[model samples]
Target chain A: MKRIILALAASSILTAGAASAETLKVCAEGAYPPFSKTNEAGDLEGFDIDIANAICDEIGVTCELQATEWDGIIPALLEKKCDAIIASMSITEERKKAIDFSEKYYNTPARFVARSDADFTIDEDGLADMVVGVQRGSVHQDFMEKTFPEVELQLYGTQDEVYLDLQSGRLDAAIQDSIAADDGFLKTDAGDGFAFIGGNQNDPAIHGEGAGIGVRKEDVFLKYALSAAIAALRENGTYKEINDKYFEFDIY
Target chain B: MRFELALQHWEVFASGVWMTLHLTALCLLIGGCIAIPVAFAMLRGGVSGWLATGYVYLFRGTPLLVQLYLVYYGLSQFDFIRETWFWRPPAYLRSACIEDLMGWKVCAADFIPSLRSAWWCALITFSLNSGAYVGEILRGALKNTPKGELEAATALGLTDKQVRRRIHIPSAFRRALPQYGNEVIFMMHGSAIMSVITLQDILGVGRWLRAKYYVPYEGIVASAILYLVITYLLVFAFQLIERRYLRHLNIKAPGAERGWFGRSAV
Candidate 1:
């Protein structure tokens, strides 16, 4: 009886393999530059996309970037809209609820943006009575609201929209990832009159260490593979190679 | 996951929720106001109507994100739009009342986005898309009007305009009531998509909450609650409208709708 059961189990596993083998479907917000944005030809090109591709290459698995909206990215992942989220999403205590995150990959400073004319430097020491704009559902929003309620905090839908208002002079300044501010707004004519206020501040309590890949908690095997792959890539110069291509500085 | 930890920040979350509700409501009110005329002109106007058709088609068909980029980024690229009558009021500056500030001049056109981009994006999409849907609804309701009623009005020496205004529109609205309610539901759901362009709807807050705690479950749950609340409110409002408009529905029994269900029912 035991032999018969064991043979059936083995047969089922083999048949399952024959029926379908899984490929890693990586999710990235193709609109976000440097971290994850699309090229003119609609190709995924960003720091996270490069890293995901390299990791897949190392694992000898076919990895695909599935462009999805940032708001629904996590929900889509939970519903299997793709396999993982490699977007520069922070691995915060709150996000860990629905899905699991890989180890911290990169840590970027969070800064507030103001029009060139506005002298409001975000009082990193205290936030009160100052209105700050940050992307809705970003660490910057959480930090501003939680740590500095004294200031007015405005939340936008995407990283770019936050800067649009800053340049238009509707906001005192926008609070966002420095890299995003630098790549998305700082380098452009829209951002010509803008400056990063309050220097780079790292408040890990609010701004969780830089983003990590997201996977279903039940995806134990894939998670283990990704965690290992991430470590190896960091040890090698692969991480730096990808980072230097788009950004002036290595994000990791 | 400790629920209390999140509950501790309930005030902030509450504020976010309130803002989202206010934003959605304002955008809908504003977007709807603009769309009605735009749709009417498209259907009624001559060559200029084609422009309306194009406007509706482009805004309705494309994803909200692209539209937002085209609006926010694409517009800023041109010096003409920045200088044109459209970009009036000189952008959001000084946080003071200047009555002359008109069009895209308010800083929020780019800066303080409570719901304007979401509104513009939503309005453009909502007004245009809803215009498309409402246009079809209007067309159908117009066609569905009883021929006998129009003949009777004509017999009374009423002009086409008077007949439409006094009798046709009112009767047609009554007929379109249920379907219009349904459209309201769809618009409510469609509003969630606005979050992509960064409208901080309930879903937006849920995402931020998730990003903060790394607790996707909690944030998602909170989002579900928010959605449920908004949906419930919309549905409640829909019910109120139905009850008010379809009060006649109550006096009749089931299957007694005497709808325009063809002569077979009579």
Candidate 2:
């Protein structure tokens, strides 16, 4: 009876997948720039957006990038509001327990930033115990809340929120991935008031590994398919070609 | 993601719920008191009177959240409020000023900070919004002051103030009891938005939890359940208060079987 039940559930899921073959729902915050952001036309444009499209095309599926709030991104996927999340989400042990992740596509070390004028340092009591901002759903928030309890933690819904608060006086400094801080935040004049402080204290805690595609734990097939495509993209020189457009060095 | 983590973190959810209830109660007590005088002012001033018109136009015109932000962020803009006031005060009171001035410091300092200067921001916004609706309720009840009842007090040789105090106020309140119950419910519902600031009330707790665990469904559902329960209890309290106070108005009141079991008078 249990075997039959398991088989029945498998068949039902497979049937659902076949029923929606043309469309694949993927989630992205679209708030992190160079990775993803809404353009003037409100269209999703960035490295992740292009990668999501390429993966869907490789897998012979039409992709729809759903702009979900960062905080709710994982749960939104678990609830099947979308089939997968292509947001710049990281693969971590804690996250692995709940969901499966595709192969690493792009990697960046976590770094910290503060006002250009502010004297900042990282050690036993790293964050000057001042207001520190981080994008809420990412590993950075978890790392900060755990490692530096003294620092006043301010969470923003998006990268834009973090950058805005960094520019304004809401936060003393922000710790995030170096590439995002440099290409995304420090690249702008508003972010110009800021400079990279140092590497993350939780550098050991956060995977600091490249980002991966997020699919439900049950979607083993999708995970492997995506992983295979990422390997192909890397070997075909397409990955390096795209990486040069966004970064000075390989993110992986 | 384990049931054990959720169980371990239950306090976060529980305290969040408790704080939300705490915030609602405080806002209602503080906000309800302020609304009464404001409503009275609106009522006594003729409809076009300056105080009455401003009370209605200003509070009623602005969104509750916007009003809250303005109160929280706008107050500390004065040098008198933060730096100057801090220096002017005796050293002993700097602690008090520091707490009050923190929210203002952020918004004043930030490009777009949440208005969270002081409790006064929430207090003022809650009072203004609740007062407008409460004023409307008071106005309706005052208008319902029976014409014959007013004359009877006059025939008894009572002064205008005495008549207003004794006969008209009492009877009008009786007539207004049902609407007033509705107003209290509305105020309670509106207090949830106060969590946007440092007021780590239930909603804020839920937000903190969701951010931490990424378990939006569980924490949010828990908070929703609490809001629902509190809303339900509030509704029951209103019905009970209405029955006790306005029972006499049953002389002209609808039958007890009327629309009294409302689940969402809010």
Best by TM-score: 2
**Which runs of model 1 end up more than 4 angstroms from their true locations?**
A1-27, A56-85, A89-105, A124-131, A156-158, A161-170, A183-185, A188-191, A208-240, A243-252, B1-136, B139-148, B154-165, B205-266
Model 1 C-alpha lDDT per residue in residues B141-204, reported as the tens digit of each score: 7667889977887888889888878767766666777777676666666666665555556666
**Model 2: what is its DockQ?**
0.28
Clashing pairs in 2: A106-A210, A107-A210, A169-B110, B20-B202
User: TM-score (chain A) of candidate 2?
Assistant: 0.89
Error (Å) of candidate 1 at residue B109 is 13
In model 1, state the lDDT of residue A64: 70
Off by over 4 Å in 2: A1-19, A123-129, A200-202, A240-245, B1-7, B44-124, B167-175, B194-199, B214-216, B251-266
lDDT of 2 by residue, B216-238 (tens): 56666666766788778878987
- Provide DockQ values for all models, in the order shown: 0.22, 0.28
State the lDDT of candidate 1 residue by residue for A1-252, as single tens digits.
323433343343234342123356778887666677778898888788889998776555667778876666787787666777898888877677778987777778887777667654467534454446776656677777776767766666567666666665446667778888788778877688788777886777767777888887876556666767777788788887887887777677
